[model samples]
Target: MTGQTPSHSERVDWLRLARTRQVGPVTFNKLIQRFGNAADALDALPDLARKGGRSNALRIVSREQAEQEIEATHDAGARLQIASEPDYPGLLATLDPPPPVITIRGPLVPDDHACCAIVGSRNASAIGLRFARDMAASLGRAEIVIVSGLARGIDGAAHAGALETGTIAVLAGGIDHIYPPEHADLYGDIGESGLLVTESAIGTSPTARDFPRRNRLISGLALGTVVIEAALRSGSLITARFAAEQGREVMAAPGSPLDPRAKGSNRLIRDGAALVEDANDVLDILHQAKRPATAEPPAEPYDPADAETGDGTDHDRLQSLLSPSPVPIDELVRQSGLPPGLVHAILLELELAGRANVLPGGNVQQAWPEDQD
Candidate 1:
């Protein structure tokens, strides 16, 4: 299993890096590229954190702590798969801010196994729930892995229908922790027959903020994300957006225009997402798309040493370029006359330092304190 195994030390360092304060997925990738491995990255954290203007010391996970997490995960019958591993989901790796590590339970049949993401509102209508369940069952029978967040209503129905065939639950919390407390049994069933995956460390509780991050993985791990029912401003819409961004298919089941739950999906169709009536609709599309023989390798890694450093004077100039209003990242790069990677790295550092906030469209805004009239 050495081919499938990430060295213990490597795993420990990855866990340490992931748990570090002010280090998000983007920062994590940068650090990994800068320092060839997580061990070196951990060693360099204090200096980098200081350079990023972090006043508090960086938190690094000890070997013992990581070992305990591994033990807990194994005891829960789950395995840890780092992003670089062969078994890591190919679809997920294509995301810009992919999870560095994910804890998975049960069997993952590699990329060849057909996978579909089913997501919808937690309080779905009865018809929506039935449609999702039936679609999931049909997909399961066809040997497709049904993927969903184990929430109530539609998500619950989908998992229930796919439980016997194959299903994967992508939780916002740790693999050992079950959210929506009532789905505890469903969680157990999936763990035994399907798979449960999470990016959070063992014992982490699901928070409202974590769910959006989790939604990305739900879309990332599948060939397409299917929305059965959702409100205009629901998490399912967020998943569909991520799906679109990742170049994965976004399929939405149509519902009556009068239903508020249908508004999110209807708008998706209007915005160019494919409309789906059932599992066959999803399969038909997948059949038409060319399947690559292997997962595409990750893009060339970012190099921090190549980053252009702005002195105090340049820093002031860059700061002056910002406003309370967010601007596009490309615009910032053009306006600052800096390399795109350099600007991104600097912006990330400022963000860690609590001096900047990232906005949509790759824009950056000066944090309130930095806003000068």
Candidate 2:
């Protein structure tokens, strides 16, 4: 969400680079920063992967494959929005590394629009469901766009309440592949009235790893995230965590102490998340909020001299300091007594070699054999 819309051929190169194996959001942004464009980034991948000690060349998506994906998106009545495009959501552009490209169906909200996400247990209680629905409706009446994953209980009810106003459904699968088949009708309704979004290709199905990515976007798209009836370990809490990390407001509805479904939300309130009883509480918080600034690309151009193609000496020195336990990248720089750029370069190579895991919140851990699976 920083640059102008890419032309047709440029868009295909973006897709090809984005779909290349091992190129996550962070890597994609770094490649763009290093090379200045997707086509050049695609050309650099094999050499970069090899420098990291990969035995085989990196597997990059072919131009034909990328073109087919673009065509399929159009066939499904959706359009692709690159992060640099003006049409990408403004709030989402604030993320350190937003989705490089997203497939969107329906129209996006106006640039000045304020969105609040409502997320919670899929097995929520009756009272919890009612509160989510009513809260979403009240906020919608105030012209706030509601955002959520199209799940069973709270998400479904929230979407139903805000359908007439505006809403956005961020999917874990392809925009066309509706999960929880029971919500097919709701999915259709949103497609026509609200926006449907996903970072996956047209034929990709939801997997265990995809939901967290979807949750990140749920929080990234909004100004704040509200949780209701979440358990101690649930996706709703994950969404709220992302909200907080992204400098967005995090709020949770109070629930009974005895209910297992209420444990997470109650804990959030205990841990200093704003306790809310209704949409008014959310509005009060939003009234006092300052919108986040858009994230900008790296200022300096790529310097080959700075991105040193390390020899085994540097790689081995870094490897000796790493363990299976997750540690901050800053700590790695301090411990290894190496320049930050060299540390990052080596770490990226280690990641492409399947020897390291670059986690959210700027953490890294050595990847185990099972982790590769």
Across 113-164, the per-residue lDDT of candidate 1 in tens digits comes to 7788999988899889899999999998988888899999888999999998
C-alpha RMSD in Å of predicted model 2 compared with the true structure: 2.2
Ten-residue stretch with the least lDDT total in model 2: 298-307
Winner by lDDT: 2
TM-scores of the models, in the given order?
A: 0.88, 0.93
**lDDT score of model 2?**
0.85
* Shift in Å, residue 187, candidate 1: 0.7
TM-score of 2: 0.93
lDDT of 2 by residue, 1-373 (tens): 4777689889999999887657777777777887889999888887777776778666789999999998999999998888878877788788988898888998656355789999999999999999999999999999999999999999999998999888899999998899889999988988998899898888899877679889999999988899999999999999999999889999999899999999999999999999999999999998888898866555533346655756777877887777888799889989988777777788777766656766666777775563333
- Give me the displacement of residue 350 in model 2, in angstroms: 2.3
lDDT on C-alpha atoms for all candidate structures: 0.77, 0.85
List the candidate 2 regions with Cα displacement exceeding 4 Å. 110-112, 296-303, 316-326, 366-373
- On the 0 to 100 scale, the lDDT of residue 43 in model 2 is 86
What does the lDDT read for residue 12 in candidate 2? 92
